[model samples]
Target chain A: MSIVKRVEANDSWYMPAIFKGLGITFKNMVLNLVGKREMITLNYPEEKYEYSPRFKGSHILTVKKDGSIRCTACMLCATYCPAECITIKAAESEDPTVEKFPISYEIDTLRCVYCGFCEEACPVDAVRMGPEWQMPGINGANFVYDIKQLARRPQLKGGIVSVVDEEERHKAGI
Target chain B: MVSLKQSLKSFLQKLDNKSRSIYFLTQGCCSIEVDNLCSSNYDLQRLGYTIDIDDPREATVLIVSGWINPAFAEKIKEVYSQISGDKAVIAVGACSISKSPYVDENGLKLTDVLPVDIYVPGCPPRPEAIIEAIRLLEKTKENRETSKIIYGAIRELG
Candidate 1:
């Protein structure tokens, strides 16, 4: 059981409390006006809060050094996705070494949960969670990002090269 | 005379922009993020956006957040019809835009009922994205022809 102390309420008791509250408010106002304390509000457009590298904002399809897409159309990402937003149409690759490549890779941005499962499921590091989050559009059609938009959008420059080496993976002999 | 008329029009536009009020429809989890936008951290009021909760008629912008059921669709249409003067509708989050995680076969999309000016795509888009969408809406309102052309060119390039 907790102890309770009885205190008498008086007309004089409220005055000191009111003055103390006002004093604190006035002090804060003066401090803010004089620029003595930093404001918590972020001037959004001018100054953006940088999220960490692991932040799952948007998807980016990585490319090879030769400016080709890195995705091998393994279907692991599509299987793992809870929302099933990713659609990959696999086609036979022309290269003797490579087996298959996605003829069409589309992600319905409006349906995506940004769960980052696709990034983790990829064995080749073909998919990554990019830093960009702003993807507002005027139409529903624009929300469906195709392979070209995912990999070779102007914002990503030419393409983001995968850090993982194919030779290193083969040498590991999984 | 033409220059003077243009100047007066621009002045009126600026005044209209300043007096714009927003009516936000809270439907799901996305409403929480929209609520965050009004707080001191985001401070949407600084951008001349006032949330009008009492009257839909007074709102110049309607922010539709989250999934809309068939029952709410009729109510949304009624509210949309009630809103007077120049109005813009914003669809915030994946649910509002495409009704994600919900089967589309029976889903009632916001776009089918009302024309959307901006589509902010995310499970629950960050407040920054919503702000950017509002800014884009304002820009389009200011110069529709030029902005459309620019936006089209950018889209084509992408």
Candidate 2:
């Protein structure tokens, strides 16, 4: 009775609060055991994971039929990023329809958060994150991944348009 | 830590006692220097000098790869200041030395202030050339440091 009075005097909620604390650690402990290997890594390159149709991984500056970057240099991705980690320079293309091709487009992978905002910000569907997420470099500068590196090497599957003609028909819209 | 210079010199000694510790900075223009540093064929890190982020107190050499954006210019200055004495900054690529027409084409106006110790000229300089530059940086022991312009033959991207 004295304990109850003391509890009321303090105006503290105890049972649920104490149980909630135990439940939090219990959930994390269970997850720790279940996700030990997963915590260490993703089995990339060998076994790539599928992202949502809306998921963003790594940005690839895509090429048209004539083998040119499709980016018009609109600066949409650069403008939208919360981190301001992307850099691109636009140039007029021989094909007027493709007004600007990125004369210089590079991303500091060291600083990029891998948010799909760049992918969504792109109006021309030229830049999207296909599944190549593993950029292992000892130097932070090496982490500055370029457009050519991103585009020439598409490590995952099924995007706007496949660089390989054989897979072109299987592109997202087509 | 002995003097900052001495600590870095010791670090380079660990790579190959004969080699000098280099402060490699590869961000905007010099980013490819990182690629050349890591490519399986080039693998400059295997040669034994570590390349870190903007931190240069641990290093005595700086390699500017790309054009520094306005935002990063101050960071570069801060990095340059943190580096210990008797340091060297290697300006790499056309962008680092002279603003490449290609660089400005994209809306990036970068001014690489002069007095660079070594100028490595190329759109994207080859890894072999970078190795050669490392060798040069290691060999120059003059007390009166001077900016040296180095050029190589045109090469393939690979």
Candidate 3:
């Protein structure tokens, strides 16, 4: 069974096909010049691309209403993280409500895969993927994001409050 | 001594005029973003950066993307040595910078072999991030303060 189509003498003509291709190009050029067509090129320095809310880029540590870190230092995120980029030092909390808290929480951005597993593993809504993707730095030391850099960076503007209710969690005993 | 400063100034001026050629030693998915940089959408050429595929000697900037083993580390050093006059090195993606999930006892980082000027951290950084790294390099070059080490290297070469 021959599925190949035979080329007729009429089909061999090149001029009409060339003209059709050129016409499309001409139309596009005209449309672009007339400002009818949107340019695909994004002037990066002058403009920026906005990723969706779900877009995972950088990691952020959520804070409680009392201006303290929301993380209870359960080490769930560290255990679940495939990259093992997250390092947390668990310490006893002064507050009666919270049993433990991370004395020092650090994430090596260079080692992180950004799988958002940390965010998913977090029971207290402590860790999340932030909207800001720009993480370029000059030195290797700068890539290792500490608690201050992660939770208390000026970009977060005091801190991003978690949706998880602290009182509800306390009642539920999470 | 005055001639040394004069020569260095001339070299910097030459660098400013010439379009920087980049040699990308890619080993992971970050290559996709590097390809995007050359595409019309990103248009790396607009910023006077051309991808050099043939020779490292022609490259002004060396971009190392992904993890490096012991053998790859030696190769990177060789490539770095080949790159001539006031060269800059950029470490792109998580793997190259720190080996990420693939971290092994024997794994070698880009920083171990080369002095990385820009570290663009991402799983696979967007092309925009890479562009920003180049922009930072450009700013540093304009200042002439950071290239003092390169000037010393050039003097040693002579």
Question: Cα RMSD to native, each candidate?
Answer: 5.9, 14.8, 5.9
TM-scores (chain A) of the candidates: 0.87, 0.58, 0.84
Per residue, candidate 2 scores C-alpha lDDT tens digits across A1-174 of 354444563357678878889999999789889975345332222344455665445567776656656676899899987656789877777864344667788886534556677877876677777544333221113556676577776453322453434134346444
Per-residue lDDT over A33-61 for candidate 3, one digit per residue giving the tens place of the 0 to 100 score: 99987898878888888788999978889
Among incorrect, acceptable, medium and high, the docking class of model 1 is medium
Among all candidates shown, the one with the greatest TM-score: 1
Candidate 2 Cα misplacement greater than 4 A, ranges? A1-174, B1-19, B28-30, B52-54, B103-114, B144-158
User: TM-scores for all candidates?
Assistant: 0.84, 0.35, 0.81
Q: Which predicted model would earn the best lDDT? A: 3
Interface RMSD of each: 1.5, 13.8, 1.3
Per-prediction DockQ: 0.53, 0.04, 0.57
Q: Model 3: share of native contacts present?
A: 0.68
Model 1 Cα shift for residue B62 (angstroms):
0.6
Check candidate 1 and list the clashing pairs.
none
What is the DockQ score, from 0 to 1, of model 1?
0.53
TM-score of 2: 0.35
Q: Indicate the docking level reached by candidate 3.
A: medium
Q: How accurate locally is residue A33 in candidate 3, as Cα lDDT from 0 to 100?
A: 96
Calculate each model's fnat, 2 decimals.
0.64, 0.00, 0.68
Model 2: how far residue B81 lies from native, Å:
0.4
